[model samples]
Target chain A: MTTAKRDTYTPETLLTVAVQVFIERGYDGTSMEHLSKAAGISKSSIYHHVTGKEELLRRAVSRALDELFGILDEEHARVGSAAERLEYVVRRMVEVLMAELPYVTLLLRVRGNTGTERWALERRREFDHRVADLLRAAAAEGDVRSDVEVRLATRLVFGMINSIVEWYRPDGLDGRGGSGGAGEREVVDAVARLVFGGLRKAS
Target chain B: MTTAKRDTYTPETLLTVAVQVFIERGYDGTSMEHLSKAAGISKSSIYHHVTGKEELLRRAVSRALDELFGILDEEHARVGSAAERLEYVVRRMVEVLMAELPYVTLLLRVRGNTGTERWALERRREFDHRVADLLRAAAAEGDVRSDVEVRLATRLVFGMINSIVEWYRPDGLDGRGGSGGAGEREVVDAVARLVFGGLRKAS
Candidate 1:
């Protein structure tokens, strides 16, 4: 039976260790031994927290997907003009990516090797589709550029936003890529500016 | 000792298998035994083609970096106005990403787990630095936007372009994200359109 969650050995703490080990060694390469070693806990101790490595994977990806899908449910994401809403989602996505850096990083790297991975991929696609629909509406309303197709535009924008995971190293503070600035807000503002510049209709 | 190259187990043939396996199972997760099984050849036969899996990884990443670094040396990339050169580089990058999908995919995913990966990371930085210099020059000359920092702009654009690996499916033709009617060239044109829309100085 799974052990009851505790502050130190809680599923959340174990998830942090699992995500780090997974990213370092890759999801397929990592084992319970590796996670135990990295977590500085015994093998049985890890099982007490979660069912297995895949459980940790599921928890991490669920957090990332939840944040992403949650963006659409936000009033800002739902209530604005299509273009305005898309921009809000884009900005919030940058913020979410930075806030949930490791979880989102793992989410982006899932190759659909397992049931949890495939489920994560499906959820991500649903999120992308919802955003793509917003872009399509914006384009149809002539608020977004029509030269590029909506779906393609959506993919490219998603690509740019998702690519943040590859860089955007978050230290204690003073993030390096924010033009020597302190936090993710600067990066998000710049990305929003750049993305809207591309997507905006010619006035 | 490496065997003399043959048609069936030449470096290129093995490379094709290696990149596929690497993408599917990941590089670190893959072993020589896995490579042999994937290639449908004996382990000794696989060794005959290349020294080992690491060599294959090095060769694959080298091929990608070589193509990318080569773009900066072309006459179009060199002699044009900074904006024009940047545009040319952007278009060429899309073409190269399409033409060399798997190799570039592997190159983009290197995690610095091994010496070869660290070397690839360094080379990737050099390529990004060169592009950022071009963007900086464009901004200085009043040809590009001054609103976003050149480095951040560079990262996003690279992120957008480099992100094709995640979505691009190159089986025969009909690449999915390129829209229904266009080919790689059209996708490149659209990307160029979007990038310049963001970067170009306002009229």
Candidate 2:
């Protein structure tokens, strides 16, 4: 009975397990055997849920990509002034990154070794370009500093935002209680402040 | 004679090849055979230079870590007020990161998979703590904004600096000539500006 209960896995549950494994053992390093063992299911059971490992990768990155693309379609992202829209996107990106931490972590780590990975990279570039365009518009509007190139600034800001995947643990794995850890709201505000006002104390 | 010339590799040259392979295949996924094939040297030839794959990893990360730690020992990083020292360190970090691009790239990507990776991670945390301490001192001196926690701010800045490895190609692999890509001086200045004055146009 326990074996039956433990073995039952929905596609969503299976994907959650797969993403964790992918992050721990890089996607290229992970095989069907490894996934099966990590998921605690047979290879046949996994194949029944998804065609193969690549399908799981596709699904995982797709989910992350969908969440990110969805942010661009939000009303706040659509109607604001260029600088405002950029800020909104930056704030939302942090939230989405933290909310779907594992999936997005997998998405960011894809090295374009396979067809699905290449597709993910292309989409990521597309997203980066769209945000870059917003920064350009903000520069043209004289809202953002022009001394720094728009493409460069966009890349740096994205780097800061995306690096969250490397160290953030919602559970406060550092032995701190949850409240002691950086909360989502705190992170968003800190990023916004640093991106705009920077670390220098305002005179 | 041609084969003999092709197989020639010093430890430095071998490390360059190994770091490239590690970045491409990931450390865990890469085997000594893969390194041998990439370097065009036989496995026995590789053994003659290093004990094993872990030795190569240790050498690569050690080179990168030494560069980073060296930045803190500079006169500017040592003698200035907290804020000035922090700025100098930040600018130097960009220079060091770009100067030792491949090594730093491998260093940043280490995931504590081996004893060497775990050591690299520990040294990284120590480096981060040292920088964070500088920021804390700067905050105490009232030169840096205190509204944002020092730890969070330090992380975001480090993320921005470290992410350079993901896309920065000194050769301008995007087909742009070297001069057309972001120059070292340009990158250093931009990081300093964005890190201090930020993206908002100065009023």
Q: Which residues of candidate 2, in runs, are more than 4 Å off?
A: A1-7, A174-180, B1-7, B175-180
Judged by TM-score, which candidate is best? 2
**Index of the highest-DockQ prediction:** 2
- Please, what is the TM-score per model? 0.87, 0.93
Worst 10 residues of 1 chain A by lDDT: A172-181
* DockQ, every prediction: 0.42, 0.74
Instruction: Write the residue-wise lDDT of candidate 2 on A67-156 in tens digits.
Output: 999999999999979999989998999999989999999999898889999999999989988999989999999999999987788888
Query: How would you encode candidate 2's per-residue C-alpha lDDT over B39-62 as one tens digit per residue?
Result: 887899999999999999999999
Q: List A-chain TM-scores for all predictions.
A: 0.89, 0.94
CAPRI-style grade of the A/B interface in model 2: medium
Cα deviation in Å at residue A169, candidate 2? 1.2
lDDT of 2 at B191: 89
Residue A134 error, candidate 2, Å: 1.3
